[model samples]
Target: MSIEQRVTEEMKVAMRAKDKVRLIALKGIRAAFIEALKEDGSESLADDRATTILRRLAKQRRESIEAYEQGSRADLAALERAELEVIDAFLPSLADEETTRAWVEEAIASTGASSPGDMGRVMGALMSAHRGDLDGKLANRLVRELLGS
Candidate 1:
């Protein structure tokens, strides 16, 4: 099933089970999907787009958790962490640092990225090929290190 469909089904399950955190997370995802569809003027979202949206939501949660923690709001941070767990359940596992390094090396070689100036080319290739799988920050660091920057 498409991610949206899966989320919808899960929402029903959450509602039935009275899972407040799961329901809230699912509702947030549903709202984001609806907003995306309205922006695109489309009736359905591709799985790729759905994954991107989920990733974005997860990222937001992570940032919020960090911010809350730094601001000394333990209760708020805990809530964000709970929401993050629910969001994470739908995300595919990320590639490890080692795997991301290998991909970065390959991208550098394939793109002839011999210097820091070629970081953009290498990153563009890497992200296009492994958007949802790899950690972008790790890949960027690898690219810079491999490029002797």
Candidate 2:
């Protein structure tokens, strides 16, 4: 099933099980998709767009969790962490360090990126190949390391 359909089915299951956390997370996903569709004047979101939305939501939850922890709000941090777990259920599996390194190597070679000046080209290629699978910040660090910059 498509991601949206899968999310809808999961939403139904959450409702049936009275899973409040899952239900809230699923609603947030649906709302994000709906907002993107409205913004783009599209009937449905492309898979990439859906993936991007989920990634953004997950990132937001991560940041919230960090902030809560920093502010000594364990309860809020726990809630954000729980929400992150639910949101992660829909995202693709991430690339491991080994795989990310391989992609960075290939991106550097493919783009002929020899220095930090070519970071953008290398990043564009790497993200196109592994968006959602690799964290951009980490990938950039790897690219810079590989490029000796």
Candidate closest to the true structure, highest lDDT = 1
Clashing pairs in 1: none
Please, what are the lDDT tens digits per residue for candidate 1 over residues 1-149?
98889999999999999999889989999999999999999999998899899899999999999999999999999988898898888888999998998899889889987889999999999999998899888888889899999
Residue 41, model 1: Cα distance from true site in angstroms: 1.6
Task: Score every model by TM-score.
Answer: 0.95, 0.90
lDDT of 2 by residue, 1-149 (tens): 77888888999999999999889989999999899989999887788789889999999999999999999999999988888998888898888888889999999999988888999999999988877789787788899898888
What's the true lDDT of residue 25 in model 2?
86
**lDDT at position 92, candidate 2:** 87
